[model samples]
Target: MSPVEPFSDDSPLGASGAEGVRALRVAVTRPLSGERLENLLRDAGHAPVHFPLTRIEAPSDPRPLARGARALLRGEMDVLLLTSVRAVRSLAQALETVAEGPWRRPEGLQVWVIGDATGAAAARMGLVPDRIPEHFVAEQLLEEASSWARLDGLRILFPRAAAGRSLLPETLARAGATVTLVEAYRSVDDGEEADRLVRAMGRGELDLVTLTAGSQARVLARAMRGTRPALRCAVPMVAIGPATRMAMVAAGLPEPTVAAPHTVEGVVAAVKTVAGGLQ
Candidate 1:
């Protein structure tokens, strides 16, 4: 058998069948994830261990975020595109920083989010989530947005992380929308968190590791640097999407199981895919 096995396009739960499988200890690497992903894994009979390897911080310059918020306040922007829950909260903080409380959005502005978590964050902020794509990737969000509204001459405000992919904004620009891409927050590596993860792998405790973003994969690979190559590749890894999978490979790690739909639910299902494969 190959040292690092890969999964096929089989149904996620196909191997479980009528019999039960052993629960896996899945290391979830998202920062401040809390119980959302954990509870989902437990409900599926898997033990999720918190191994946060990345943390979010405010960008060095708040001017761009402030400008984006001010544009929305002044009704200068026609659309708001949020890619992550962190982006939604960061942008909202920028709004409260610029104006008084209870500042409502311009009625003409349409709000669209990428993930269920992003939409939920918007709803928690008392903002209506006008649209959310069925899939949680930027491409899906762009497709869904284009399907509903005319992108021509639209002034769209995209509040996201400092190192986010440019595909969404670039594609929107090509589609004739003027996109204001703001770096609302930045994801930084947590040295202590990385140390803990490396320790766990050394102890051989983790059955699988989950990667949500490219940063997480890169951090993990960097953290595990100098360790035995086989030790790092011993456990299977699952990524939330193609970008993350590519990150895993580029980080000198084996290719990861890419989640379909790229949602948190899809991540849960990916873990199940690994579980079913083990059985």
Candidate 2:
């Protein structure tokens, strides 16, 4: 399956050209990746704020992660699936923290990533993915898996966020694939950051809210209640993809303006597009 199609120049949310993003205060909700987005926004002449809604941490229980890593090393697993770049780092951390001596990935084991960013993360650790969906998303990853690989009885090791979507593993299991899902990382909401966001929203200091992950959208929604005027805030949510947009709606937040290419640059273009049209 191809990646979700990117947005066109004439995106539904009015077009904000390059000049439209000038001096706009954009609140970013991504954690470790927020810096990258901030840089992009700055390049576009928009003011970017770093307000991480959640923190990605190592799992409370490390045994499952260690076991999964050991299985892959021993060639007991056929595929290693990474959903996010953070997952790749977390997996490496789990392996080093749990095992002794130098850790080496087995040669025969195939690795699959959900997107280009995750694939780049894997490559940084010397683990190149055999396949990455043309479109970056769990559903697309599953589609590619079913189309290319024989899943019946195939053992796949999936290391992902603790609260990651269940569609990939659940669907793979139904297809008779022996999938082992382990939590390599955990996403915990940062109350202090949420408070700052509440304050910003209350004073109308925030011009735009960007949600890179679905979890951040949920956290932002809860934070909204602390604001003096919740519904009237004209701040538009900028979501990186449809999944995040869905989460925003499910949480009763305003419908987000979506980024089509689903990259940081896509997000900048989305900002320009929205800001351009809203002007």
Candidate 3:
């Protein structure tokens, strides 16, 4: 992908002069989906660092998901909460393995998405959400749960990564809802890439770091902690959503620029805004 472009106005680092520009480093911690953020950062004249911390892995057994799909069709699930596009895509793929032709989403199913992207993913599966919260986090989702009061006795199906924080499930359970947690996928570490990131940070070669998800932020924090040079780098971080921003903060990384709306375009806009403010 092309590097992120600079802001239309002077960048924050640009105001600092050549020395400041040299110190402006960015490190991308996750695999970028589009070129908007990268292009914006590069245009701003900052050296962009691209380091993907984890690789997405499909589940070893699709049987559970297949069963979940069958249950969903039978109206066993009252609500479907999707937190990520990956979860939707993984569930769709799993469904195809056991289901023939186009599988229709059951009616009367209250669908809730954590964000717009996840909603779009659900739309791809021919399922539109009943509600979508503004903040793309489990806390936000829980707070918005009141909207589905009619779904009181509902059985909610949450398909997510195998290993992740239990906030969503725990919160739903506390809300007096039956939540079924399914491991749709997993994220595996990339050691070689982690090493490259550490070396790049040590050399002060990175410019802007982008974290698309909370899981990615956690992976990055772990990787950085393992290397002192990476920890000492002063690269600015860009979080795609609140959860990611929280992860960055919890990891004690430098304060990050959080994207509004929590979308890819929002992230790109945040980079441009931050870059411009830098000047």
Clashing pairs in model 1, backbone N/Cα/C closer than 3 A: none
Residue 3 displacement (Å), model 3: 12
Which ten contiguous residues of candidate 2 have the minimum total lDDT?
Answer: 1-10
lDDT per residue (tens digit) for residues 100-211 in model 1 = 7778878888888887888899988867789988877777787777787899999999998899888999999999999999998999988678778777777777788898
Weakest ten-residue segment in model 1 by summed lDDT:
1-10
Ranking by lDDT: 1, 2, 3
lDDT for model 3 comes to: 0.71
**lDDT tens per residue, model 3, 39-84:** 5555555545566677788776766777787788777998888888
Go through the candidates in order and give the C-alpha RMSD of each one to the true structure: 6.4, 7.2, 4.8
Q: What's the lDDT for residue 41 in model 1? A: 79
- The regions of model 1 sitting more than 4 angstroms off are 1-19
Give TM-scores for every candidate, taking all chains together and pairing residue i with residue i.
0.86, 0.88, 0.81
Better of 2 and 3 by TM-score: 2
| Candidate 3: residue 84 lDDT (0-100) | 81
* lDDT of each residue in 1-36, candidate 2, tens digit only: 111122243432223425554356678878764467
Best by TM-score: 2
What ordering of candidates by TM-score runs from best to worst? 2, 1, 3
